[model samples]
Target chain A: MTPPPALPPLLDLTGIAVFALSGALLAAKMRQTIVSVVFFALVTGVGGGSVRDLLIDAPVFWVRDPWVAPVILMIAFITWFTPSRWWEGKMLDWADAVGLAVYSVLGTAKALAYGVAPVPAILMGVITGCVGGIIRDVLAGRPSILMRPELYVTAAALSATMCALGTLAGLPLFTVWAIAAVAGFCLRGAALIWNIELPAYSRDP
Target chain B: MTPPPALPPLLDLTGIAVFALSGALLAAKMRQTIVSVVFFALVTGVGGGSVRDLLIDAPVFWVRDPWVAPVILMIAFITWFTPSRWWEGKMLDWADAVGLAVYSVLGTAKALAYGVAPVPAILMGVITGCVGGIIRDVLAGRPSILMRPELYVTAAALSATMCALGTLAGLPLFTVWAIAAVAGFCLRGAALIWNIELPAYSRDP
Candidate 1:
């Protein structure tokens, strides 16, 4: 078999940092203890991919690479020590959007690289992007975003589609990342700005 | 292959109801919506075994036997509509202990019957007994009982050992169940009454 194309370590690092920050912010909001916050960050940063690996009988990623855990912990510690009031504005929202965008593209790329069929690859992307946050919310005893009419999953789906299409068209890796990240960021940003949501069904008496 | 031993439907029904009740009680404490309450109950009651089956490549028990879902749902509905205070106090604790005891023995028995070694079987029993509650606590955003200094895991381990020993000694199934269940119940009850906790280590200066 031909060797698989290499991905930039910078791209992976960016995605991991963003995802870890998102998890830390959520844990901070929940007022979790320092240890719990760090645990949540680590789990949210890696939980989906871990589950995917386990299901596919692959060696778990973090077990092979110890760097992921320390990076997540560092992010968690920074978030925990930082005052909430310092982050209580558009900056927080923007950081979250960036994290979502990065994670979506990364998930799609990883799934494709794993040689999964297109459909399962796309599903895995969505699963990888959203499951970590869903788990975070579940652990916080909040309604999972999946049960809500948020633009989160829609943003992920769009980004994943872009990544898959770009890969199939033999686009450069950086180009694929740029396009997919822009799509996810724009979609999610617009949703937050306009309070956009999926239409709800009303139960009539 | 030798013919599989027959398992009575009544025992299955009883186990399902007991587990469902425990799940429902936890959901009520968490104040989840009706749909979430029912969903939690069903998942908690069947999830551990389903995970074990999936990992072991066994046909999922509920998939093969459809009756389990309905029984769980029925119990959930009953718990939902019942007076909130009805199952409170000592009764709820008793119910929880009973559910844990039954599930632990059932897990051990199932693992042994499937020809798993004694060590894995006992571990499976502890997992099956504790995982549902862990998932429940995680989703409810509470510190899992496993994370706390409690007699929870200890009780399950003891009961599982008894069941494994009983099977090795050629004791009757019901006798094993009785011995394991009573031991588990008493241990858990003691923990509850005494606020027993595991020792926590303090950081050195």
Candidate 2:
């Protein structure tokens, strides 16, 4: 079998870095030790991709790759020493949006390469983009994003579905990847800017 | 590579059923719908094993096994329709303790069969026994068992560590499995009956 198409390194590293930062930031917020911060960063950075690989019956990606843990550690260190205010702005959200988009698209492409069915492949992509955050939130004892009506998972779903469809239509992998990421990033950015939320279910008492 | 040893079907089924019941009961406590109960049951029943399979690079056991989902569903159905009072006693906890012991032994055995080192194999056992409860607790918005000082995870660790050492010492699988599980179960039972708790960490204010 042909090797799976390699994801763009820039996008992949950026996603990992941002995700590690998010986890470390949460640990910092909780006033945890440096060890906890590093632990959080490692899990958050690799959680989604690890789950994706597991479902596809592949050797876990991080175990084979040497760089992932170190990069996550570096990010955790940076977050640990930095001022909290530096990470508490709209900019961090924008970075996370980009990471979500890129990861979703990459996740879809990898699943398709492994011959997964389209719908499950799309779900894999969403899992790859969103599960790390969910793990982080759960570990921090916060409500998961799925509990909120915000557009986070929806943005991931959009990118994943788009990537799956584009691949099915025989689009070039790089082109489809870029387009899907841009689309997801736009939606997430809009949600951040507009404070958009899905309508909550209500019933007359 | 040699195939992993098969666990006793009765023990396996009991573990799955008890874990599903625990998940469904949590959903019921939260006043969730039947759908949520079923969802919770399936996840909690399979969650630990799924994580173990993933870490071991094994095909996810549930996807291939026909009986797992059906059994979980049956348990969920029983849980949903039963009066809360019917499940309000200590019986469920006892059942869960048995399941935890059996699962920890099985998980360690499987990991060793898959060529994992002993320490990590022991961890896989603990993960297989405990992660489902963690997921169930997180989804129900309750503090996870990990956050408590109970003997729960420690019981799993005991069973897993014993199983690993037994296998290394060339003990018969059946004998080792029984001994390890009984040890764990006895400890857990004592904790439950006596309300044993670990001392909380303290720091000077």
Candidate 3:
């Protein structure tokens, strides 16, 4: 069987770095120790994909390739070493948005490649992109994004749909990735800047 | 395939009730809505075994049988409607211990029957017994049992090992389950009553 086409290494590295940074920043906010920060970062970078692969009976991607963990660790180390002030402002949010987009598209593409049906593939993409951060937040003793009224899940779902549509339209993988990434990033960024949230209903007595 | 030997229906119902109660209690502690409590109870009753079945490419037990969810939902509804005082004090703790023991042995026995090797079988048993609660806690925004300073994982590990060993030594399934359940109940009971905890290390420079 022919090997899968090569993905651009730089984009992959960027995805890992951004995800690791997102986890590390959250760990810092929670005042977790450096060890915990590193652990969270690694989990955020790869945990969702691992769960997806395990469920689908695929060999775990990180187990087959070791590069993912090292990149996560390096990002975690850098975040921990940097002064908190450097990340205390707005840059961290931007990184998180970018990470969410990249991971969502990557997850969708991977699921499609694995021959999952479109619905499951879309769900897999959302799970992969969002579950890591949810796990990180949960472990850090914070409410998950799912529990919050935020547009986090919405962004992920929309981005994954874009990826699935692009694949169905037979777009090149790189173009699909770019389009999905932009969609996710813009949605998340808009949510952050505009303070957008899903509407909620109070209990009717 | 010939149907496996029948388990006593009463015992199965008792186990499901105990597990469902524990899940409901945890959901209450997490301040979830009634809907969330019921969902948690259903998943906690069957999630671990479902995961194991999926891993081994076996039909998911609940999907095949459908009785599991109804049993758990009944327990959850009863718990929800009952006065808080009825479930308060020491009774809740006892129920939790019983649930832990029953699930642990049941998981190990199922794994062994599925022809998993000894080590993976034992691991699967522990994971199956413990992972549902872990997932419940995680999703409920509580510290996972793994991070708790308690004897939770240790109890599950010991019980699972005993179950695996008993099966390997050709003990009858009922006998193995009984022995493993006793071990788990005692361990967890001791941990709760005596406040047993794993050793912790200070990250002092």
Tens digit per residue, CA lDDT, model 1, A95-139: 767767777777667777777767777777777778877877776
lDDT of 1: 0.73
For each candidate, give the TM-score of chain B.
0.90, 0.95, 0.90
Cα lDDT of model 1 by residue, B117-190, tens digit: 66556756766777677787776767775545567777777788798999889999888877987898788889
**Candidate 1 wrongly placed segments (more than 4 Å):** A1-4, A55-57, A201-205, B1-133, B138-205
For candidate 3, write residues A85-191 as lDDT tens digits: 88878887788788788888888787777666565667567767877887787777677765566677778878898999988898887888898889988989999
Please provide, for model 2 over A1-205, each residue's C-alpha lDDT reduced to its tens digit, 9 standing for 90 to 100: 4478877776778888887887787777666655457656866788888899988876777543546656787898887777777767665677668778888988888998888899999999999999888888887788887899889999999999999999899988889999999999999999999989878888857
RMSD of 2: 6.7
lDDT: the better of candidates 1 and 2: 2
Predictions in order: chain A TM-score: 0.90, 0.94, 0.92
- Least accurate stretch of 10 residues (summed lDDT) in model 3 chain A? A196-205
RMSD of each: 8.8, 6.7, 7.6
CAPRI verdict (incorrect, acceptable, medium, high) for model 2:
incorrect
Per-residue error (Å), model 2, residue B36: 3.4
Instruction: Report residue B128 deviation for candidate 3 (angstroms).
Output: 4.6
Q: Is candidate 1 or candidate 3 better by TM-score?
A: 3
How far out, in Å, is residue B25 in model 2?
A: 2.5
Question: Which residue pairs come into collision in candidate 2?
Answer: none
